[model samples]
Target: MRSTVADVMTTEVASVGEDAGYKEIVSTLLERGVSALPVLDGENRVVGVVSEEDLLHKVEFENDTSARAYWPPMRARLRARLSGAGALAERADEKAAGRTAAHLMSTPAVTVAPAALVIEAARLMERRGVKRLPVVDGTGALVGVVSRRDLLRVFSRSDSDIAAAVEDQVAEVSRWDRGEINAVVEDGVVTLSGPVRRRSVAHALAGAVCGVEGVVAVTNNLDWEIDDVAPYPQMGV
Candidate 1:
């Protein structure tokens, strides 16, 4: 079965309340060896995420005569322009003077459900440019945290286990016995070689094997009896 975020997440996560002081957040992060902390409200529901980058923004602007030089790219130019230059400058100054997690955190925290697939968490992290994600329950309460390292644990599955899973996937996809389609796994690479009844079955088998957990790569050497993918000649259409 595919692993979910809960399967590998660290349940004992370190989090900070919205009113937590900046120095307290920094100390918690260092003590826990985490790069970010989920900001929780009074009800223990996650409201935001405060990362190293968010904290660095304060230091980046502090004592700087020209904050524009340290400003992030114009990714939010439309919003900045709409708010006006003065408002944007005020916001940066506010962040620099901020003392609480609520003031410094990135709101609408990028969170993932505990039941989400590990791949889904990995993709969300990549798309959001985060190194970790807060695993929340249905009520938005923090249950755990999943990092890049946690999601990569699936790759540690034994070679034998991967091979067995590949064989099972091939059998289910093609309804072919071991003799009809052979699967050999080395390290995490799968090499399938044998004869298939239909061209479509070969493609299906390869794709199914590729989805198996711990599969590093797939080398398909299967031959088919018929060219099922070829277009048929039109007859007086």
Candidate 2:
């Protein structure tokens, strides 16, 4: 079975209340050595997240735009414009005026369920451009937190373990001969090579091996005797 959020998430998470002050949030982040903290309500339910970038906005926008002696150089402005940093700066300026977590945090915290697959959590973080996700229950209460590092723990499994799993779970289940189908694992990459009765079986075997935990990549080099899905030639009278 695939590893879930609960399998590798850190149950002891550093969080802040909605009423936490800016300095307190900074202190917690620095002391805990975490990039962000989940903001919870009175019910301990996650509402948002306050990150180091969120706190930096205060320093970035401390001076008003009108106070500048001269406009930024054309090149600098062009780079900012291309990266959308200009728009982000405007929003940061607005956030800088706030004094508490409620006003400073990014709302609608991106979260995952404890039962969610680790890959799902990784995809969520990638899609949202965040480094971590709060693990929440069905009621949205924070239970733990999962980071990119946690999701990558699967890759640390020994190569022997990966090969064993592929051989037992994938090849045997697919009815492929243990000797015929060679399962070679190296640095989490699995290479399946041999002969199979049908092309479909080869594809299915490869996919199954790919889903195994700690398998970084799958190389299928199975020669098939028959192409089951190939269209047949028309007959002529």
Candidate 3:
């Protein structure tokens, strides 16, 4: 079975309220040894995320005034190069002068459901450029948090377990007898060796095994009776 967010997430997450002061938020993050905290509303629903990057705006723009050093046009150009411009820069300036989580948080947090696959969570983290994600329930209330380390726990499965899973996948995908094909797993790497009726079937089995949870890599060594992928001889008129 595929691993889900619920299987690997940390349920005891450290969070803060929207009205939490900047110092309080920083204390919570330092005490918990976490880089970010979810900012919740009165109903305990996540409304935004307050992270180190958000707080750093204060330090980055501490010396700047309402009328920043750069002129509007130059600031616009800098915005394009720095990935923060126009209204975004304005928001940063506001954050620099802010004291509460509500003023400093990045809103519309990227959250995932409990049933999400580990791979899905990993992809979301990469796409969002976040180190972690808050796992929310149907009501949009915070439930747990999943991090890059959590998703990697899947690879901790025992080699024996991975081998068994690979064998099962091979059986289900190719329907070949146990004696016909075999799997060897070491350190999450799978090596398939044996013979199949066609090259396509061998390739399919390899791919299926690759999808098995905890499989780090797959090595295909199945000899095939037919090379179906090879270009067919051109027909002569």
Model 1: lowest-lDDT 10 consecutive positions:
170-179
lDDT of 1 by residue, 13-73 (tens): 8999999999999999899998999999999899999989888878888777775566655
lDDT of 2 at 94: 62
Residue 196 C-alpha lDDT in model 1: 79
Task: Give the TM-score comparing model 2 with the true structure, all chains together.
Answer: 0.84
Give the worst 10-residue stretch by lDDT in candidate 2.
Answer: 170-179
Off by over 4 Å in 2: 65-90, 173-179, 229-237
Instruction: Please give each candidate's TM-score.
Output: 0.86, 0.84, 0.89
Which stretches in model 1 have alpha-carbon errors above 4 Å?
65-91, 173-179, 230-237
Instruction: Identify the leading candidate in terms of TM-score.
Output: 3
For every model shown, the clashing-pair count is 0, 0, 0
For 112-141, candidate 3 gives per-residue lDDT tens digits of: 999999999999999999999999999999
lDDT of 2 by residue, 1-237 (tens): 789999999999999999999999999999999999999999999999999988988887677567444578999988998999987766677678879999899988999999999998988999999999999999999999999999999889899888888878564745643336778899898888887788888887888899999998998888878888666778982
